[model samples]
Target: MTAKILRTRLDCVDYQEACDRIQNWAIQRNSCYVIAANVHVIMTAYWRKSYQQILNRAALVTPDGMPLVWGIRLLQNAQQTRVYGPDLMLAWCDRAAQSNLSIYLYGTTETTLVSLTRHLQQRFPSLRIAGSYAPPFRALTPVEEMADRDRIHASGASVVFVALGCPKQEEWMARQQGNLQAVMIGVGAAFGFHSGEVSQAPRWMMRFGLEWLYRLITEPQRLWKRYLINNPAFVVLFGLQLVRGLIKGQ
Candidate 1:
């Protein structure tokens, strides 16, 4: 089942369950997308009907942020936990290696892709990386878009990990839904985290739902508004949602 977070329908699956579901999709060669729902994701969807439709139609919308995990616990599931994007990517990579699934990486810079692919191959020695591409930051021309689709299709990848971040990644996956023949997962900053370009929060901080603070401190300039504005807003808005749910006996 999915838990309602504002306007988004977030899948109420734990880490293992999410992994199993993705594995099944890969095996079936399904063209589907997964979004890792965070506070920013929910808030973005709250304001954007187009993005909200994307989230609503996703194959799985895992709670990638601590706040969303707590939101699910409060609203629907009592034992909800975070299915973090970076960690989930790693888990999928591990399972893909064992299952002999060839994977492709999309988005991020060439440098990060090099480092990420190297580290992933190091971590999962038997993993097959079918291909990797770092699209230009600007919107792709039709020719370029077709090239990307052709490259991925020709690579024979069963799973494609997208690290374009936010609505861009989600939107890109949505665009490729029918055109691509692989399970597309919008992994946001997993490329940076896996490539060693960005450090992740410690296990203790993550366990305590303070990873956002760590990220805010690490990249204050880039993330200040997202954490500062969105965090408080989500608290207030979601609090109201909780109160409404309670009054209705949900």
Candidate 2:
């Protein structure tokens, strides 16, 4: 186990560690959710106690963004790397191929799912993609939600990668816990990035914590508020938490 940054419940774990834990969850058929904690997610939880409880209850919360990596290092006195959600999805797919773990993909457009499945199976030839589905972009009726759950259960998937984005994906995973006997990971935009439907930031930018800037530039209309508002708010709030911790000498 890795030391956690208590402010955001950011686990100070690297990619390999996260993959190992996911593989363990698959073997155990555990019903739990993995959150990829980024600045936006941290800020969202900060502003909403309900959302914070969701984060608190997550089985694993990887430091997905570089700022979170930095936060863990600064606060925990331990170095940590970003376990990026998109890359983690790929890593798990590669491991799943060798381990014989079947997976399901939920959320995103049908076209994106098609492309993602194609690319994944091409890369990990032995990977078992049990099924994929793109739900309608609206709240599902109870019957529809149950049908979706049954579809996943019937597919015999050991892991489900959800791409519904942020709080919605987290909430959905929370609701499915225990009811869904598989690892439910909220992977945000992994579907788009993996399928090449959306370009990812370059390695240099990602390493330097500039991935958010790249994303903001790429999809300004959709991401402007998230980056512009959440980023600064996280910095300020986390700084306060740090100061308070120091005053208390934790």
**Separate clash counts for every candidate:** 0, 0
Stretches of model 2 off by over 4 angstroms after superposition: 1-7
Worst lDDT window (10 residues) for model 2?
A: 1-10
- Using TM-score as the measure, which candidate wins? 1
Residue pairs with colliding backbones in model 2 are none
Candidate 1 similarity to native, TM-score: 0.97
Candidate 1: count of backbone clashes, pairs at least 3 residues apart or interchain: 0
lDDT of each: 0.92, 0.89
Candidate 2 Cα deviation (angstroms), residue 102: 0.4
Where in model 1 is the C-alpha error above 4 Å? none
Q: Write the per-residue lDDT of candidate 2 for residues 1-250, one digit (tens) a residue.
A: 4544434576767778888999999899999999998888988887888989999999999889888888878877466678999888988998899999999999999999999999998899999999999999998888888899999999999999999998899988988888998999999998999898889899999999999999999999999999999888888877887898799996
